[model samples]
Target: MRLPILLLTLALPLLSQGQTADDIVKRYLDKIDGSKKWKDVKSMITKGEYDYGGIVFPFTTYAKAPSQYKFVVPFNGKYYAQGYDGNSGWKIDAFKNETTPTLLNGSQARAMANEADVELEIPFINYKAKGHQIKLEGRDTLDGKQFYIITLLKSGGEKETYYFHSTTYSLYLKKSIAKNIELEKALLDT
Candidate 1:
């Protein structure tokens, strides 16, 4: 009897340590200024410095609701532009000796389409409608700050893990399964 009682006591804390993904997502949206405000927004524009390859490149992005995105980066003297217009996407890149504007295909096109629809309010707004699955990975700590870890698994098997503030609900970080130049405007004010 003592053995069973001891085991049950230990299990109680572990059981209460986790929450359903839906519950976490709902609370997160509520904490981040609610969904009512998100409905009114149709577009967003942000300008910030991009840190990559040890060089800081300034970038500006314009996004339209549903599926449209454009990013312009001035390199050296020319502006490299990339935009996704609904079903198609294009890129104006700088080459070694020449600059070229080319259309994107396959996964690149699809990724751009997905990125184009990013809203300022958190990605989990219509998560279910988008056929994305969420899993709560409990909590973690970094630099002495605690964060709630939630993983979003996309339909195509792409996974992105989001770390949110454990108490304040602010977005702490996100790790993608692959290395891609993604525009994360809604969170970083960039």
Candidate 2:
């Protein structure tokens, strides 16, 4: 009897943690954009700079719903581009001397297609339906600032961890590892 009661007390916190994780994600999403508006998102275009080994290159990304995407980077007066046009994937790399648009195949094509698919929707919105899982990993400090740590396991086995502001509930940092690629993004303006 006492053993069972002790077990229940221990399990309660564990169970509540999952619920709390879900609630935190919901609040973050609502703060970014309501669920209804998230679903209505059809396309997005983002222009930014990619820094590689101290070299900064301007890049543009275009994505559309139903799986369409294009990424372009201009260098040395030449354009390097990758795109998935709903059905097929293609690329043009000036450094590789592939001036003509080359149709991507095999893993390359699949990777580009996957990017388009994910670009259509923001993760954490209907994460369960998307076959992903999220968990609250307690609190942590980043850059001398306190934050709530949340980790997301994507359906494809990728892992992503997010840091939300302890008080604002806004996402402050995100780190992800997918297919041998690791990326860390800071959302200071977000």
Candidate 3:
């Protein structure tokens, strides 16, 4: 989904040298979310496309504070839905002949649960309190542009690497790899 306001705030500058991970994170957050507007958001609805392989599906996402989220996508004349109610994670895969909500378990469940909790605020905000660790992994270049690499180690041991534009200080890309699980869990659970 498009974050219109945050996208418009990407003009901030980055640290020059000897910047710690925390310092970089603070500046990044301040630039894009200085007003802390997300704190006042109790709920949100985002409509977008879900790209699967080379195909795409139109989807609508519903999120409410304190851990509630749902997304529905229509495919082949049927609607498929997945969500986490305040208590449990569930999904209905119409293609699999599952028309009713089925409780999720294992990594899938934990991933969804974690997503509901984190989506209320921007990622990296209070990351230590969230049991995540960050490190400045030096710099890297992608397509001729310089970027600062910051890696986040999740409590679950999942690793996510964020690429921030060196000059603009905007997030350019994020890459993640599951430490143990077969499927890599996404930071946004996207």
Model 1: number of backbone collisions: 0
Q: Candidates sorted by lDDT, descending order?
A: 2, 1, 3
Q: Give the per-residue lDDT of model 2 (tens digit) for 43-148.
A: 8886666555456667677888888888787889887888889899888888788878898888787777776674556788889998999989998887998788
Local distance difference test values of all predictions, in order: 0.72, 0.74, 0.71
Better of 2 and 3 by TM-score: 2
What TM-score does candidate 1 get on C-alpha atoms? 0.62
What are the per-model numbers of colliding residue pairs? 0, 0, 0
Whose TM-score is higher: candidate 1's or candidate 3's? 1
Candidates sorted by TM-score, best first:
2, 1, 3
Please report the candidate that would top TM-score against the real structure.
2
lDDT of 3 at 31: 76
What residue pairs are clashing in model 3?
Answer: none
Candidate 1, residues 1-190, lDDT tens digits: the string is 9999999999987775666777777878888767788888888887766555446677777988777888787888777778898878888766334366578888767767766765665568888887889999888997899888899997667677888776677777776532224443223213
* RMSD (Cα, Å) of model 3: 9.4
